[model samples]
Target: MPLHPFHGRALARAIACAIASASLGAHAEDDPQRATTLREVRVSAASHDTSVDPDLPSVVETVSAARLDRLNVVNVEDALKYLPSFGIRKRFIGDENATFSVRGTSNQQSARGLVYLDGLLLSNLLGNNWANPPRWSMAFPENLARVDVIYGAYSALYPGNAIGATVLMTTRMPDRLEVTGEVQAFTQHVHDYGVDRDYGGSRQSATIGDRSGRFAFLIGVSHLRSNGQPLVYATQALSSATGGPRPVTGAIADTGANGLPRQVVGINAEGQEATDQDEAHARLTYDITPDVTAGLTVGYWSQDMSHRTETFLRDANGQPVYAGPVTIDGRRYTLPANYFAPSTRQSRNYLYGASLGTHRDTGWNVEGNVSYFDMDRNRDRVASSVSYNGAGLLTAGDGSRWRTLDLRASHTPDSIAPDTHTVSFGYHYDGYRLANASYNLDAWRRGGAGMLTAANGGSTQTQALYLQDAWQLVDGWRLTVGARYEQWRAFDGSRATATAGVRYAERKETHTSPKASLAWTVSDTVLLRLSAARAYRFPTVNELFQGSFNGIALVNNDPRLKPENDLSRELSAEWYRPNGVARFTVYRSDTRDTLFSQTDTTVFPNVTNVQNVGLVRTRGAEASYDARDVIWPGFDLTANAAYTQATTVRNRRNPASEGKQFYRIPRWRANLVATWRATGRMALTLAGRYSGRQYNTLDHSDIHPDTFGGASDFLTFDARVTWKASDHVDLGAGVDNLTDRRYYVYYPYPSRTYLVEAKFHL
Candidate 1:
């Protein structure tokens, strides 16, 4: 069946608003909690909420469903954009996939962040980096209840991988039997110089579930489609030295024969693409006994995508040449072979998992989970190349398939004293396999008589043991200490690694990290916080085992690179009042063994290598304020600002390169959000975000070319409107990127767009 398309963010916002309206109404009859605004605690930072207090050693942020709705955040990447410390880059290579980096620690070529769904690891085991474009589409956006971002490394808690940050997502639970759905449409325009082009798409989702009497179930489906705009580029011959066309044969023939005549030809930019997604989830709870409870959850997801494009060939005179009929590998071919799509690619994925947990008053809590995932991609052409055999056309084809399994268990103690103490521990295991099996048409058409297919597969197994202790040392004073040990092994391949960390925190006005902090409650309305700790991040699969491909150039992974480590410290102060809240924090990180892509001149087209380059230092500060109670009932306003500076301290061949600013690391970023409740059942909100100019590449060179360098600055605005129609029903509408400004957060991002949505609940 053909896939469907829709604007993801618009759909999510509409659904969130409807759910929020229903939840609020259901609780209106009960007494509401006091409005003593406090930063929400995040489970991803640690295994439990004992670390929720701001006096802890880590920096954490939480995005609730209500906030997501207000911002029209549809995917995980979009949700993280709200955090000033996080950066995202979406490219045309992977439509549904985007890249995420936290602080300045991310590996631009391959993502450095770790992803978890309800505490289950989503990192690709066959490779080190998290999957490109993230597997976010695996779950319907409306299913997300909250997202937890834990900044800095928590090797002791998460082990081996905790580097720049860890993202954890928790889906919502049905409160009662319910049915909900949403539909949205959007249009976009991209104008280069005076030429103008238009593109647009639509999306829809329907959900049915029952949440009552300890039993809940939810099933949903979502789809999106778009007619993409064409791409333009300056084409050149393969070589200027060789004047005549070289023999077009062998594996490298598609790149144009060594001396092939080349000329600039306008490429067609017309094509259509679509995606279809479906999901099913269920949760069961039983009060095994008065003090004990058991819960089970199961979920499944699937997605399918398809796209098509056109191809062409130019002659020496820079004009179209009727190459009649060319034949290769016993197949006949034509210039505009209906099969060639210049910018065509397609992929599909299926995921499912289940988990069980038990809670008891005996001061003991235990949970176990297991999951499976499979993904596949098919391409009509290997890349932008074309081939011909004696018979006709032999389009190059490629396919990738992945399968994974994961298991985890955790246990926490039940009770203690006023100085409440708890020790928690857990274990995790993962397995993965990837296969590249497709016909190499180019290889055969060049003279090779046999079919060619490149096939390689590998697996990885990792184990971690960690323990943490939380102690309320004294009134207004808290202490946390923890450590973890991790080991990883690759089968059919060769490599093993291990690592560890410790942290401490104190509540005081003047605090020092990596040392001590002293917080004094000078008054009922004032308090101080101080903290310090050491953090680190290990290398991922892509950095160590990935092979090179042709795009920017050839590249290879170096398995010899070591893990990156850091020693960090931070200080902060906060003030709380009946009507408002304010906070400020300053932090610095001393990082060593940073990884980067290095060139190898020894090989033709020099292959790129991943290496531990040098030392880096980063310092930053952030301030925020929010007012609600003092501004009149039903009204709230919040503003936040941050500044960061990062420099390379040392490197291999160029010690002078030290002090160079890190690439893609913005110096200033900020945001503001305001909301007004016109009535008890109606509300409106506005939000604005800004990012300072940042260099894209690491070399910091404008003349010398490198993949990572460029500069960009952007501003975006969004608005939302909501209405409570009745006790059980609500409606909402929203607009994102309201200005429809054509810009790029990174190169090749989609241009300005508009979206509208409608949601219903029963």
Candidate 2:
């Protein structure tokens, strides 16, 4: 559907009028002497790390605790599902590989976005894949006060990672004694090819905090466990003649869009992944003076997972030949019953941070923060493909570590001139270290020892300086201008292959980014904004140094990969009333040297590596409407829709890929939520989410339906009800994907799921 230029204005006026009329008529006759206020003003100071004011031209959205609790989400990522132009690729309830996408960006491009907790970076930034996602498990949901999502990288304090969007989570420090606990249980009914069963999960969390004099402390803990469905399916190529040693049970022929016939040999190759997670966090703060505060925080997280698969292809005596030669169509074929590869993984992480800051009523304020994250342990053991019942291979993992330091100061001069300025300057330093190794095990299923096969390690450091000024040119006009200079270096980078000894290299580069935004308060109830920026994202160590060997044929990585540079622009309009807000924004971005994992298929066996894709472009528009009380009391609604066209503008390396849509990004997305408070203690909410068609491959050839790697358009409905039984107790029940819509992100997504929860507050 095409958007009319006047739709924004019409929708805004309709919402404002409805809210004003409802508020005035709600028991207003009883108080005729009281005056009505249709508009409310909200003022907030600029955030030091983001360097953005609430009233700035940039687009920013905040989700409050009340709204978050009503959603009854399982994690921080789940809470953001309903936001405009935002999507989370959560395959299952407790999927650690879950990632997010914003606007034109895909989940695989993790470096395009940024995630932060308490002004500290949480995005892994180690590699752009599912295994390397933001450390969202670090913060317990009970400890979060609010979450802020800033659109675009139109801020000097942030790096190019913010080119997509920036998510900032703020934790709360109770001013008084407080205690909270919650327990939740959920189950999903799944139905798919060779997979039809029920998966269950549960979570438990608790938090306690207290404040006395100038000292405050808070602590929280959470545990989660879940059984996920199959991760992959087993299949075999179809043959013209049927002579395959008597077909096995449950073997069915299928044809895909590519006009090829295949037989499904069995159910899920890696079946039912069971995972357990435990996490804890603590925060301590002390007031050194009336306006100065010092704080420290520590966080720990760990997970253990194991899974096994079953093969339906049996042999002559009812014995399963995990791997052997089979006669198919009179042609001898080496079929592997061990195609179902099972594995186990164990991981642990720790985080520590300290901050000192002083907030003043006027003049200048300064804040400094230092933090570190340690990937203490990460190991994976896989069953050998050659022999499933025999020994396996162990990838003894050596993980990564990162540290950051930020020092910033902001000043608001005590001037009475017609114009006012809020100046901000900051210095940032970030360091990352990564180590990975692979080993060969004698027996993985039985916990056998292993010998090292290949190992490599690397480190990166970045230093940056930025300055920004938010100038209020007049009563209703403002302009924000900023610039940032960053120096990035990769040192001690090396790769060790089984055949080759080792290769090491070091690289360095510098870039400068500039941003500018203008805002105009068109009227008491309407506003307009325009913003633009130029940003660059440096290549990651894995993208530059990691290489894979296919049967001793080395597929080399590009150490001289150029940084991704983006030029972005946005125009937005907003209308606000006391009870509602409506907004519309149109944005465009052109990026060069986009990093992509591609295959140079010209060789006998395809070689894969991260390379620079020439140029890409995206254009999109977003419209949103939110209201607390539209036409009736105790009722609220939120609705949003987004349309995006992200495509490759130029690709010299592969001419066929040009003009194709980006992978895994939908052309249209929308969400709707309606909540009704039946009484003072009871409330119900109904919501629906819709994602349009998208491709899983760069050439847009994934047209198969209900098949893995062929993602199709999907829509789902959800409903929740909450009952406040008492002042300190609450009970809730909800259903997600109520219609049981089957979907896939390469891996089949969850089906109709039900959840029940109970919480207590003191």
Candidate 3:
């Protein structure tokens, strides 16, 4: 193997760092910019023009931990709320089911995007829905160094899931002994139909780490407790007769068209649920040689939550109504106060992984990482009926695991070709398995073997090979091209019940994804890039085998769902200066066989299942401006705007949805933030975000904006201030949704929330 011109320089730098750290009784760490700087020099050496690769053909953005701290983020989702064309449906603080959306990707399609923590996959690919969102809680904000958001599937290094977006989070590795602790308290004031009160929460965390010689170790733990507002609303049809056997709850004037008595604006029967969560994580790293490193990591998370509700309706005797009807002035009414069922849920999750990697400036560099996640415990119990009868357990036992292997080789020719070139080739393998089961129960108070309601699972495996090359064709032009071939298979697909058993046949698919880009240096301060790509995303285990159960074969597990394919193109331009940068991108995507879950109530009987649409198209543009020390020595500002129009073009299976906008995707959004360093020990920041109205159904039939059922436009404000109280102590306070903007994304979002936090470090 031959070596590049900068190979010797990179080696000398690495050796120098190693020797310096060894003599100081420490472990060597890679320089943050070493890789980028070296790659730039090598690319320009052939053209005899030395210029940095400041702007790649692809659109990528990075958010550093320092910026997160300045914003006083509350969680991993909060830290990413300001990214361009990106959003997360976070109903409340400590929400377990937070789902993210980027560009044209909707939140309901959880599998369209990918997330990684230090090269370990955190995305839950077993299913594609709100419940199967990435394990964001497993990634602690305090442990993160930075997060990179890759906008498109323009690289062979990632799978087709990157067609929507790829989020990579890198954690901090301690160079020396360190200890940190934090305490936080928060509260929100809610004012909906029946809910007019304050709910609160608290969190505490600690971390410790050290690096000595050739080994390093770190451990972190966190605990949180919260009382959240109701997630479900009670409703009744306006067309229903007033007289009924069931009791009635106090009614409120209807807001939608078919006006009828809906449940009064108040907490639902389940009321507020109190939640308790705990997380623990540890990692150990060792240097096997001067150029090789090995590491192991383990993480565990658990939750205990329970809640009970009280009805507002009462009988003649003033007792809270539980059942039966009542008459007033010869008028009869049906009340459902008796059907309020409270519930409790307990679950525990675990994650473990191991990795080995090598680094070298010249020749080949390779890395391998494998991870497994298990659902240790999952059980939910609910009241059998509205009479406060015995409780019944809903046996939902499910688990999934993914194993990934990657190997790569890259080298830059010592003797330059016609143009400077760096070539890379890699092989990848990933296997995923899901086991799901559910059971019916007779008595809620006691646990016993009940009839099996559902039992099904499936597995998906993929093997892929890819080759990529980057060439600087001339002094001011560069091109990158890559292609990947993947073979995918779904096996062990089955569905069964205690009385009847149904099985599905195995499925297979194959695709070739190609990517290309051309970048031109327009001038010393401007750069322009145009790119295009073709990608495919396969169905998950749940999408292929998880079926709804009824008396008949409605929504039978169809084993022949086709993979989704997308053709995308983008044009981007960036202007750079000493103090700030501005960037704009316009992109479009045309997708075929798009997978989505649909409600088919008119199919003789109601049935909900996942289906594929013929074609869908999306066009969008994003612009952002970032500056530091804008008007003062310590002032920073960032502003961004996004517009996207995602619509179904053709769908033979559901023609009514054609020409309608995609669900839960706002067409317009804007975000702005400003930060000021008031003093050496103090900082203050303020932010604002706005989102336009969006649809909740494929046909866009939901026109009314009710607090509980429809998506509504909203704008919110946030502010935070932090002060260094001492050398080892810090204090901070912040307010989210400062304007108390009332909005809904099918569920009421939090309003006017405040938090206070304190931190100690050594």
Candidate 4:
């Protein structure tokens, strides 16, 4: 908690800005259009701006409300699935608990991807742990106005754990009283398999505000539920060591010979058992002025799992056995019992902030803002089981609590002709605290083993200051330069340490990010742009100083680890025509000192160290085509495809995986979405996703085997039909996973399902 350094950095940035302004007068003025229009506009693009311009160098994609409704995307993950650069792997279908990796950075368990709701940070400030990773459950898709995806390193602007990409979710703000609702149900059948699964959910939302357009407020709530099935293939595999049939459960216990407890084996289908999920969210927004707005949100999620296999005890034979007695964390339980395992997660996030921006009459414009973010998450996992002695037992009751406070502010200068420029400086203060406690049943069962309870908690605070400037040197070319300096300190009462990253980006573009190409407006219908940039990522608290607690022994955190930095450059061109649009981009990211988990053979079960393993180089290409008002009136078609190759360029000492492929990062991914509006009140849509094979683990060991980890591909289809019953009422029906292709994605995704719903507005 030192204030001197932060103040000094701020002062230095102010002085630098003054110096730049003074020097601007002497330099040969570049194209005045470059300085006045492109430079200032590009700076706004670097941070947050809706308008798509070519001068910005970062890749950004926006999902529209109309698109959301057509796809019936209920969660944040679904909303952005069409983007070629982003991928999501969920443990269950119809569940918001998912692992998201964009541009291959989020593939690692320790990877950090920042999430924001209306500019409020949702990434946990606690030590980096998947338990507290930014979750999709915080906001429902039904309440979103739009989702903006900013790809690559953005820490220089947002300042936190933003390394791979930033997902900005903006809630719907209404200008008039409006209400909408939908209910859906569907069944999925695995191809070549007789098993068919069914699931469904419903949502209702309302927005009440005035049409005056100056002062307005919007409040909405959404609820969803589903009975999800397991995605892993349940078929058994023969073990090479014992020649015994191995069940494909991932990390769960396995049966041994004669049912006697043996070594745990591999199982594919052993993921979250049949489970029911419930989620609810509420958002309130108020527009204080035409240039400023504020909002608050609250969300709750609960999961109830039935028949979840806690442990696999073996019988006398090598065959798998379900009925038996077992002990977990020193608690004994009987089989064939409910085994009820329930977990509840809830979050309350508040944002009371405003944006003040203006275009001066003198042609000098300025934009600045200050905001406060308070976010908290509570998670509890409880297990209740029956004992062989016919006694009721609650073996494990564990819970964790996390809270974060964030404050940020930024400023942009006025645009000057031919040399127009914007210098932005900001400071961010982030405070995070976490507490976890786990209980032991053996202590209470044995009548006083001291009532075993292990607890740990810590706090961290960080202050960051950054300065960025966009200078227009010519009409078609611009330069963007910025650097961020951060100082982070963790307090365990007395012990503390600090870390920082200084990053910069320089590029020229005709449009913002992907829209940046080489094509120029030779005519009214032809335009082109091309550009590239360098981005970096910093390590999170969990990856640096996290302590281990989970039963899995291979995963461990290294306190001495350094930050992972990368140089990412992309080049692309696009053609915009009256009938359709086609764009393609080729990108490469050379990462040095990439932080990754390295297994420690020094231990029996093997521990791991989160280290700057070596260098990783990734190259990829993406193409997309969109045709609006296609052959049929009111019909639209969009198709996107991406191919990526990621490999370890250095790992001289670790031969075990020196050149192995990264985990969970597919080399190829593609999607297609089409929609047709037959009438003002009716629409039909179809969508599909495909991902190439990927490795599950770095070592490729059967114990952590690459079996459930290999390449998997599946095709799913969905369609929705809506009808306006009256001015105040509307009805709709939809089917998800229309083909019901039984497939595994990261885990088991839900099979095909159908739903029907109706809504009434006043």
Q: Rate the local accuracy (lDDT) of all candidates.
A: 0.50, 0.77, 0.73, 0.50
Candidate 2 per-residue C-alpha lDDT over 75-144 given as tens digits, one digit per residue, 9 for 90 to 100? 7787789888898988778888778888988888888888888777888887777777899999877687
Lowest-scoring 10 consecutive residues by lDDT in candidate 4? 506-515
- Model 4: lDDT of residue 137: 62
Model 3 residue runs over 4 Å out of place are 1-57, 243-249, 256-261, 265-271, 307-310, 322-338, 361-363, 387-391, 412-418, 442-449, 552-556, 600-607
In candidate 2, the residue pairs with backbone N, CA or C atoms under 3 Å apart (3 or more residues apart, or in different chains) clash, namely: 322-337
- TM-score of each model, in listed order: 0.74, 0.91, 0.89, 0.73
Q: Which runs of model 4 end up more than 4 angstroms from their true locations?
A: 1-55, 109-111, 125-130, 186-213, 231-377, 382-417, 441-452, 493-536, 549-555, 578-580, 601-605, 700-711
After superposing candidate 2 on the true structure, give the runs of residues whose Cα lies further than 4 Å from its correct spot.
1-57, 240-242, 257-259, 267-271, 315-321, 325-333, 385-390, 414-417, 446-449, 550-553, 601-606
Q: What digit string (tens of lDDT, one per residue) describes model 4 on residues 578-673? A: 545455678777777776667655357766666675788888877666555655557676766677777777764354765766655666666667
Q: Which candidate leads the pack in TM-score?
A: 2
Query: Going through the candidates in order, what is the number of backbone clashes in each?
Result: 44, 1, 10, 41
